[model samples]
Target: MPQPEDDPGSAPRAAGATNAGATPPDPATVEKLRSTIGSLSTATLKQLDADLPWYRGLRPDERSALGMVAQKGIASFVNWYQKPVSPEWVLSDVFGTAPTELTRSISLQKALQLIRVVVQVVEDHVPFLAPAADQAPLREAVLRYSREVAFAAADVYARAAETRGSWDTRLEALVVDAILRGESSDALRSRIAAVGWKSQARITVMVGSAPSEPNVGFLNELRRVTGRLAEDVLVGIQGERLILVLGGVRDPAKAYPRISELFGDGAVVFGPEAESLVAASSSAQAAFAGLTAARAWPGAPRPVSSEDLWPERVMSGDDTARRSLVRTIYRPLLAASNGLEQTLSAYLTLGHSLEATSRSLFVHANTVRYRLRRVCDVTGWDPLIPREAYVLQTALVVGRLSAPPAPPVAANGAPGTGNGRAARAGSIDKAPPVPLGRPSAL
Candidate 1:
């Protein structure tokens, strides 16, 4: 018997070689076994349906493929009994008889179970196939062949798993790339399903530097670790960057602190939660932007939220940060009444000094403190802390930038706001008065 190696198709050949020494049954017995191949195959299929609920649940084509495997195994056994040739032929002749889809659909354990059923059926029929004198050697040959096919089945599954892992890695990369690029399509959705992402509850994107010399095992180890942290996670390592799409994390810090330790020494940033993978593109963009912008905050935490790095992200010219700041702080303050926007603006601009802001706004210091408290209440950002104040200041700038151009001065000296349809009833039809120095042509 040839020694089994780690390479594909080697172990199976060794198994075939092991079967080489099994004494072939008598001609009458071999002929009977070969002739009854059809009946034995039928019995195996019937036993499969009766004994294995999972087999009955299989798609019709998959069940049919497994039946073919049984038929081929029996046929190969009879042929090997007569010929007893080299190792190369057995894998192709026995296990290879089943299609790739069969292996993919059914696990190695189930395949072994199928082998057991086939061996059992043949054993039950041995009495009819051969007389008592011929039965022992025939049973021994069947046992040897079963051992060989079992090893072959294991080898095929190992190879299939290796191939699948490689394919899933590439597919994950494609899905992550599509997310970062903001490409959503039927194809991308299908690819996500193929990659087996299950974090349907909440999706988040994390970006950081990649560890050195990350290999297949390195990624596999990460998968093992993250399998517990988040419900579903897709990991992609690009050049020096590592990106992860985490699903089902209500609070990333609680669920993901362990993951941050695994990242390369640098800032790790998590984007806001997204509703779905397609929507996660927005989160991915934000996380990438924060990672690029994280360097500006030397004192930033090991793992910081993208929202927390808005100041640096704004400096990096990230539109997401700009919009986020304007929405979260600028718009909220504007919407809240009682001079919250004005007081907060004064508080930040005047260097977080309550008295100075009160003096500038001609309000009581107590009132300034009250308005700052209200600012926190309305915007969920405190203007009291220097860092929070700086964020508020940036939000003010972004909000101002995002504001519409000063409504063009109207002829009647009122701000010409809104389209004509919503303007003063006659504004659209009224012609402008000619300039004082110019000729007023009719």
Candidate 2:
């Protein structure tokens, strides 16, 4: 039903309201609206300006406008003392003052409340640009208040952005350092998961061209693919390698093709499914071992995992076979110099006789004794026993195969002096390579 507009002659309702015919605003709703304005965080309020009406956005002229408005309100209110004026005039008289008077020290909460009131006054009746009568005190008060509120809002958002940026930078540095040191894949998976990463099952490692500047969106796409392909998957970087760990895969082999396509010509090794991250860590270790093998022996069409080479590792562990290999490889080195060879052969053959080999090498009894002792110390083997001799022989052959290539022989027909090889060949009677994890210097 239509309602009649209020007659001009009728008394008006209270201020901060629409026309009398308009539905009366609920007190609760008004309070809620006011609270929302008062509670707006500086960051959130700044966001509103992106799409808010022109009058709502921050403006350089806002301070002057506030000062003028406040001066006018206070002046009009005072002037009304001489003659009758509208209720708005009375409101200005009650509240308005110079903008300069509203100290910049006001809190955001207080500023927000003041701005809402200013907006309300403009909406109710007056244009913001209305000329000030003699209300200089009111204009100054409102101008100062508006300036303080705007400054508070901006200051809050700037502080929040700075805090967030610092956090993000620290996290990036931690991740990069961990990768280079070869951190376990499962740990990385757990971290990424807490930050909304969905991939926690199947794993593959990926290395980016510019890892320091990660494209989060692209990595996120990779995470999404793993989720669809496996139950839980995670991707991370380790040094130059990108590691992906897969968990709870229903058919690991079936998913391999898709991962291969995504990580072409990259170190994309996969791990076995496991019940938990600890199990996954073990599986990742196996994958890493396999990856090490693949790198050493390339030309395999597909990526391999550590589980694939368990048989070889086991077979290579046979004690008898290893002993035989040691004997075959080092017999020649022992046979090279007659004086040295015969002494070594006799020392091993006759149970390391300082007395027997002394007579055998035709040297002074003391000299034979001294050479045999030196041989034991040099090869890390007891010349009097077979076991230590065999162990040392095997290690020498293995060291030849695995150690870095001997530094090139020098132009003077001498091995380079600074490198380990030059040092070793310089004294053939010196110590051989020690066993793994035990320093040769010892």
Q: For this target, which candidate reaches the highest TM-score against the unseen true structure?
A: 1
- TM-score for each of the candidates: 0.82, 0.32
Strongest candidate by lDDT: 1
lDDT of 1: 0.82
Off by over 4 Å in 2: 1-234, 246-255, 264-267, 296-301, 311-442
For model 1, residues 1-442, the per-residue Cα lDDT tens digits are 2223444744334533544455655888778877898988888889989999999999888887888888888898888667655445566677564647767779888999989999999889989999999888778777877877787787778878888878887999999999999998999999989988767777989889888888778887888878887888898888999999998865665766778877888899988889999889988988888889989999988788889899999998888788889988888888887889888888777777888989999999999888889988887778888888888889999999999977665556677765554566566458698668877799
Candidate 2 residue-wise lDDT, 92-114, digit = tens:
23234432233332333544554
Reference-based TM-score, model 1:
0.82
Give the local distance difference test score of model 2.
0.46
Alpha-carbon lDDT, every model: 0.82, 0.46
lDDT of 1 at 350: 75
